[model samples]
Target: MATILSIIPYHFYPPVGGGALRCYNILKEMARDHTVYVVTSQPEDTFTSDEDYTLPERVVIISISKMLLHISGSSACKKVFNAISYRVKKRTLKGPANSFFLASYSAIISLLKDVKFDVIYYESLESVGELSGPIRRFSISFTHIYDAHNVDSILWAQQAKALQNERLMNYANNALQLEKKLFKCIDTFFCCSYEDREKLIRLNELKISGIVVPNGVDISKKPYDDDAFKYSRKNIIFCGSLNYQPNIEGLLWFYTAVLPALKSAIPGLVLTVVGQNASYDHYKALMEDESVNFVGTVPDVNPYYYSASVAIVPLLSGSGTRLKILEAMSLGNPLVTTTVGAEGIRYEDGKHLLIADKPQAFVEQILTLLTDKQKFDTIRQNAQKLVMEIYDWQVIGKSISTQIPVLLKEKYGGR
Candidate 1:
């Protein structure tokens, strides 16, 4: 078994978003056949506490801050200086930059001493810079595998378009440049979708094809149920990390444009918004609306999935496949999403889910789905079948685990 070093920016203790879910599953798979060592960050609250996580026995987790606190404060000061220096040096260049020089990474630098790893897995381009200190400290030949969560440049650019912000556009451009530079050191690229893979190839003009490892659902978590298609009070469900800029923007757009029209048509229409970190005050008017119910973060979203008549993803801009869609579909929840919402997933528009871009078009589709029994049932079944066949976490994880050994052999002559 290979001794792999995986670096991630956040803790996967309570896997929440797409990125976290992917990281958690990949590590879980890797630990099955490898001695996986993880370098990750925790909330400042966990800085002094010994917290037990849901990790396999083969996995060894080391907090970047946990190691840093053992070192003098001067090391952190130097890290800050380095970050500022690097920013100033790159000021002439226009592109997105990774958050590598964070003080936590500086702390991580002190912890790589005398450790050995056959391969290094970079969770995202953002964590690419953490390798510099480790590489400089230990001169070893190890394979570098980059797991591209999203074409972050395109994602940022989409956000720019959605919000119409020039500053975000500039940040997106810079992010593209930084990612391009980072890819130069990557031996293999594990992309989330073919769309993202093609973007990488076009942007970098690469000779080799990327490995597609799409985000997926843990099917074993809950049993599949077909009751998600039941036509009740036309209760609409929207689930995601509400604090995320794209989700926030999409939710606001739906609240303003689509909900009003739907409510007018069906007097008893109900919209259930479920997820965490939502700044409720930002949408005070929407919150006060009698029909709209915000069920802030819950332990299990399965109950909501089973309760709602239809699930909606009115996303205007984002990158990567929607985990919410996969989770909803796994429960046989009928979906109504925009083209951007269904970007990475391979789904037939009318069969798996309904796709409508315009406000009026989206409202029309929602109304039709609520009123039409046959169409909704067909979509619910098709979506469930698709996810069961293609997006199961067990399958996706095993695929990555099997391929990594081959990649290691190809890159460094052995696994």
Candidate 2:
């Protein structure tokens, strides 16, 4: 078995977002056959002494609390200032505000001592700088694997364009430069989509290509319940963290442009927005509307998935494969989504799910799916089957683990 060290930038257990879920699932999968060590960060206040998460006994989790420039559980004003200051200092410092994060690396390195890891799996490009220095100093020979949740540069640039924020724009530009400079250090790149892999290849002009490891759902953890499917289901579910800009942007667009038309077609239809940290302050009208119900954060999202007739993904801009789609599909719900929403996943329009970019098309697709039972059933079945065959965490985890030996062979001529 291989000894793997994974470095993540967030408190990964009890995954609260898509990125966290992906990291946790990947670690869980790797722990099945490998001695996996997780080095992650958390705010000092929220750091827990008790290990509450469900994981294999073989997996060792280590947290670096209150690391450099890392803040959590802070007030809104504090958060805003911290964000701005971090960005400003990042530019002034000519590098990431990762000094404290890098310092935590020493603790991790000291803990490992003489033990040599066969591979290093670093999550997100943001951690590359903090990890690179320590890994180089600690080990002479080890394969480096970069798991790209999204093309950071591209995603940042898109967000900057959307928000028109100068700091974000500068940050985006800086990320682009950093990615180019660090391209040579990565031995293997695990991207969530072909689009991202292609972008990396074109940007860096690298001879080696990335492996597409799409976002997946843990079906075993939350298995599909056939009884949850209702013949008279009038609920249209939209699941995503409300605090995320991309999700909020998509929700605003759907609420204004598409929801009215869809409501006109099916008067009884009620849209249920489910997920954590969804602020209804800007969406006061939606909150008051009887047809729209905002279920702000739930411990179990499976019930929402199980009860809905169709799930809508109205994403305008984001990168990487969406776990929302996989979750909805795995629960046997038909989906109507925008082109941006369906990116990276091997989804066929009108087959696995309906894709619509414009307001009229999006509304029409939802209406058609709700009216046509045969089409809805076929699409839902296709989606569930597709996920079962391809996007299951076990399948994805195995695919990732199997690559270690091959990458090892190429690097050292033996596993």
Encode model 2's per-residue lDDT on 1-415: one tens digit a residue: 8898888777776678899889888888888888987777755444344353467776877767644445543578866655565455333444433544543656566755866788888886767755665566666588888888888888888878888888988878888886775666667789899998888887877765688988998877556546434535888999998877789889989999998888888878899988887676756777788898888789888888787788999999999999999998888888999889999999899899999999999988888887777888888889988999999999998997788788888889975
The numbered model that scores best in lDDT is: 2
The 10-residue segment with the lowest total lDDT in model 1: 92-101
Q: For model 2, where is the 10-residue window of minimal lDDT?
A: 89-98
- Compared with the true structure, model 2 gives a TM-score of 0.89
Query: Each candidate's root-mean-square deviation in Å?
Result: 4.2, 4.8
For all candidates in order, the CA lDDT equals 0.77, 0.80
- In model 1, which residue pairs have backbone atoms overlapping below 3 Å? 95-173, 95-174, 95-175, 96-174, 96-175
Number of colliding residue pairs in model 1: 5
Report the alpha-carbon TM-score of model 1 versus the true structure: 0.86
